[model samples]
Target: MEGERAGMKIGINTWAWVAPLTDEELARLAPRIKAWGFDAVELPIQAPGDWDPTVAAELLAGLDLAPAVCAGLLPEHDLLADDEQVVRLTEDFVRHCLRAASQVGADVVAGPLYAPAGRTWLLDADARRATTARLVDRLRPLAAEAAERGVTIALEPLNRFETSLLNTVEQALEVVDGIDGLGLALDTFHLNIEERDLPAAIRTAGDRLAHVQVCGNDRGVPGGDHLDWRAMLAALADIDYAGQLSIESFTAPALAVPMSVWRPLATGPDALAVEGLAFLRGLSAVPSAKNSRS
Candidate 1:
């Protein structure tokens, strides 16, 4: 039953259906997600106006569902930038996001919180290390603040094209090492693109992993396409990553965020969440059944 609880824990990222969700819609959606057998839901904190975390907490708690928060800071919100005001504003946002996560009962807050997504520039080796050092210094205070609220801040690495700073687990680990309350966040979509060996990368992340986000290679439903889900889950198990494996894919036919992730996946928004939960459940059962028979 211990393993059952760990393996059965699956979450859905709400941004895939953000277009169709208002505050009232989210209130309705929480119960529906619980009905679909999800253990939790992930809400993105882009700005103060993105969503109401207090209301979301009531809804999720009512349904006995867990919540996780993802940061959505922009380039102007850069913590490593030369501008002091930018760093201050970015820290404020991080603090707000952390408070929101606490209110929503989130155990972890994950995203590219070190710097802004889609903001990239070429950096020499020395400059990269310096930038990472700055990121650590800026994030340390915020990480401590989050720790007080019992929330782990997971730092994510985007693809090389998206950001030149941290493109792999090794880079993220180096950037986050010795940070008291920080951990790594892995996204399968980014993993499929950047990792030379996906399972090996997961193993590398190991105990440092604070959160996991799953989607197909094309950023769709987990099992609707050709991803090695078994291998990935096995690696997660090997690492003892006792965190929410949330499904995170964006909606298509309309570009919302400026990240340029416009790929059209085969599954619709609602179907993606429903099917992905089923797929994770199947994956979780296989090892437990084997262990039982053995």
Candidate 2:
């Protein structure tokens, strides 16, 4: 944080250590996260009761660590599905997360909200268009809800394997085009897979980019794998996006197979967090165009 671009903050997700983070886990991990020099802690809301927002708010405020909120959508939370009940359920969950974020003093709730992860299917051009219309309609009201609570819905686009719709910045932009309270949350892992040029995609997102998630191309430690970290940071600088670069690698045992995380990225979660923080901090000391401008 010493030499970071003005207004830019770095964060790490609780998912990097645990899934469905509880208030107890947050209390335990937050001190270490602050000690490691993270500006914020990205908290996950896998369900409404996964954590207590009031407790989290107090703990974070006490440690001087900012709070961010991310969400996990199950198959039942698909907004584009044919079932009205399913759409209603999804809306309820998202609203709960937005309220939780507001309670925890987080300005944004970031995640793939249109459809559940791992829900993919074939779609003809005509069907795809129809689905897009449905998505926009469904999300408009939620965007309004987020705005009312002073929270932005940072919609994320997953890879082809995770979801069929909204796989690129262009697609996501289209959905959020006329929506005021909706913005994009780009993850480097998904960008590496779906984007032909990562930096260009970041530039395209521009001011609408609300949140950012970083990890190695292989879903490991940020700087321990093959990714152009400097270029990515530079593109962020070009956009003047003063958002948090939250690390979002997953390590929960139950998530290994579903997430396809077959190999260990570090000796343990602590090592991964510490190493990634060190590498990113080192970037701040290196002279670059962004640093020169600063």
lDDT of 2: 0.87
Clashes of each: 0, 0
Model 2 clash pairs are none
Model 2 C-alpha lDDT per residue in residues 125-205, reported as the tens digit of each score: 998888888899999999999999999999999999998888999999989887989999999999999999998999899
Candidate 1: 10-residue stretch with minimal lDDT: 284-293
lDDT of 1 by residue, 115-228 (tens): 777878989999888888888888889889988999888999888777888889999998677776788999998888899998899889978888999998878888877777
Query: How many collisions between residues are there in candidate 2?
Result: 0
